[model samples]
Structures are given as structure tokens and as C-alpha cells.
Target: MEEFSPRILPLLWRRSVPARRAVGRPPRLSVDIVVTTAIRLADTEGLEAASMARVAAELSVATMSLYTYVPSRPELVDLMVDEVLWARGLTSDGTFRERVLLYAERTFAMYRAHPWLAEVPRARPPVGPGMLAEQEYVLAAVATLGLPVRELNRAAAGITTWVTSAARHEAESALLRRTTGLSSDEWWQQRGELWENWFDVGSHPTMTMIWNAGAFDRGADQQAQDAYEYGLGLLLAGIERSVEGDDRVP
Candidate 1:
């Protein structure tokens, strides 16, 4: 097997070689134009619709011309993610809980605005100014807990993972509803016969008890919001306990 070489980091760090200047006229397309156009396409049509050919078509340029600005689709996506992060610029002010909640809310809002973002894998996130800024904000917020550097790092990572995962779930659910033309409630209602005919109280006594107690009566949107809030409260409480030298935190 061949060793994999990465190209995106150079472009992201602005160390990639400049496009060869054409002898005749100045180039019409720019890196910003290509990236912004790709972002717009992804916003409306999805990540798949932001292909080089499609973006080039939107910009009225030859598909090959896009290479002058972006190396490839993956690089373009990296650029797009960084641009969105840079534009949003998460803040680090307010009380610790307030700051964390605000950051999570803003991140979720970004996913809502650009659902395609939820599709981008961030296991090895792009190391650009935007990503660094987000890291800085997260560290500053987590630092309020006054944990050691190791604990602070772990807390930041854990919080980011939880918040992003929740946001992704929300975005995916919205996309499913849009694509299938059916709200979650409507979908469940369509399957109502299972509850009416096949539901066994003995087999699922807890579920039956909860159903009778109206525990599952809320709208999907409200349920999702409530779940997020509940989880956030628990997370903050845990952090507070850890700060007080709780042995369970480890």
C-alpha cells in the first residue's frame, strides 16, 4: 500500500503554491469565490450538490478552473467548514454555564443554518484559524471550572463531542423529515396499529406505564429541546462536582 499524503493542510494554512499567473488576462476566479459558492450550494442543496462541476456551473466557470482555487472536493469541504466557523466566531464571555450554553446553542444554530455541516466528519478537523478560534473559546469557557490542564482538556473535548453529536442528531432528523415529507409524529402515527394491536403491557410494563403517564406526549421539537437542556444541566452539574474534588468524576 502507498503512504497517504495530505494536501488540504497546506491550502488551509495558506502555504499552498499560488496558481500560475496566466500570460494573457488576470484570473477571474478567486479562492474566496470558489469557497463561498460551494458553501452556498451546500447550504441549499446539501454537501453532495456542492461538487466541483456543480459549483463551477454556479460560478459560470470551467470545472477544471476550480482546481486553480481548490485542490479537490475534500479540500473544498475543509475550506467551507473553516469559513463557516470563522464567520460564526464563538464567544467566551458570560458565566460558565451561560457561556457553555451559548456556545452549544450557537453551534446548533450553525448546523440548522447549514445542515451539510453535520455531514462533515471532524475526527481530524481542519487546522485553520477558524478552528483554532473555536478551540480558544472552548478552553476559555472550560477554564472557569479551574481544573488542571489535563482535566480542562478532557472536559473541553467531552463537551464539544456531546454538543456536536446532539446538534448532528437534530440536523439529521430535520433532513429526514424534509426528504420524506413526513413529520416524526406523522410517521409514528402511521405505525399506530402496532401500539393498538401488538403492544403487550406485560412485555413492556415500563413503556406502558410511561405512556399512561403522558411521559411521551410532547411534540418532537419540544422533546428534543428538553432533552438537550436536561443533558446540559447534568453536564454542568458534573463539572461543578468535579471542581469540588468529587471522586466519581474520574
Candidate 2:
């Protein structure tokens, strides 16, 4: 089998053509099966657990044979990420703000369900159909507003970025609690006692006041969600103001 290149990765993902196979014999594996198995491993364990060997083992195939469908573990992971994102439907009907918020909420839910996605390094944009579909969805929502091309791209990116950050926060916190066997409240309770003993509350009157106001009593999950919704509202409001101020926008 030939090595996969960045130029050809999109072709492979879009299924521009079926993968090369034997003439007289039916293939025993497929790219979808390989990616699905890898995703299962990652979802059940962690990203590191979805090694080529483990994925092949789970599929009951020779490790090298697995390469016939997926060129490398990185390629397989890329495919898995796209597959997960593709499964999520991102569409809604409402005002522009409402549509954007609905999409943000769905993206948040997806990341929470697949926390391993937070570990993936997206240094470059993904070109997979799934990712592009998501991009198209956002652009379609904002297209009627008549924003410039630059602002349109920025608006789409802003909403997704906000959701990704919020989702990562919640997912990381949950993972930490699972690893340490301590709930957020329990961990903070212990820290609270230590602060009472050695910390100088007088040094930070503003924080001290907020802390005393029962703000911390709200669970971390609730606080994270509240902050995300509040911030999203502010973000949408700013965008609306920009649209209204710029006569160029429709």
C-alpha cells in the first residue's frame, strides 16, 4: 500500500473513491470499521489507548493488515475525529442569535460526550467533510446577515471556540475528579480550611466578599454552565450591535 499524504487525506475521507482492494477477493476490513473501533477505544479509555495495535486487536486483525485501510495511527485518529463530528447534526430555525446559540449548545454537548476530543491538537484546520459540513452549517446561518467574508469567518469561529473552551473546562474537571476520587466540593472544602488557617483574607477584600456571598456554594458544573451561557449572551449581543452599527451589514 502507498503512504497517505496530506494532499490525499481529504480524498480518502470523502470517499472520493473506494480504497484499493483485491480483484477476486472481498476485503476483510474497512476504513469506517477501523475508525469506529479506534473511537470506541478512545471513548472507553483515553486517546493514548487507541494505539494501532489495540485497535487492530479489538478488530481481531493483524496489526499490519490494519494499515491497508488506515495509513497510520494519526490518520486513523483524524478519521475518528471527523466521524464523531459528522454524526452530530447542527441545524436550527430561529433568529440569528438563537441559531448560533443552538449550534453552540450542540457542539458543547458533543465535546462533553467525547472528552478525548479535548486532547487532540488542532494546530491546523481539519479538511474532513465532517468538519467542513460543520463550518458550512455556521456560515449558512450567518450568510443572510450580509457580513463581510472576514467577519463571517470570524463569527463562525468565535462561537465554536467559545463552546470548545467551555466544554473542555467541564470535561477536564470531571476527569480530574474521577482520577482523584474527590468531588469539586470536597477538594475545595479541604482548601478552604487551609486558607482559613494561613491565608490573609484582608489582602483581597473583593474576592473575600464574593467568597462569603455563597458564590462558591454553587457547584462547579453549574458555575461553568452559567458562565458559558452568560458569556455566550454577551458575545451574541456584541455581534448584534456590530451588525446594527455597520450599515454595510444586512
lDDT of each: 0.83, 0.77
| Cα displacement (Å) at residue 40, model 2 | 0.8
lDDT for predicted candidate 1 compared with the true structure: 0.83
Regions of candidate 1 where Cα sits further than 4 Å from its true position? 1-5, 15-26, 245-248
lDDT of 1 by residue, 50-133 (tens): 999999999998899888889888789989998888777677668878888888988898889988887898887788878887
lDDT of 2 at 135: 86
Error of 1 at 124 (Å): 3.0
Question: Per-residue lDDT for 109 in model 2?
Answer: 81
lDDT of 2 by residue, 49-98 (tens): 89999999998989999888787877877887788777787777777877
What lDDT score goes with residue 121 in model 2? 70
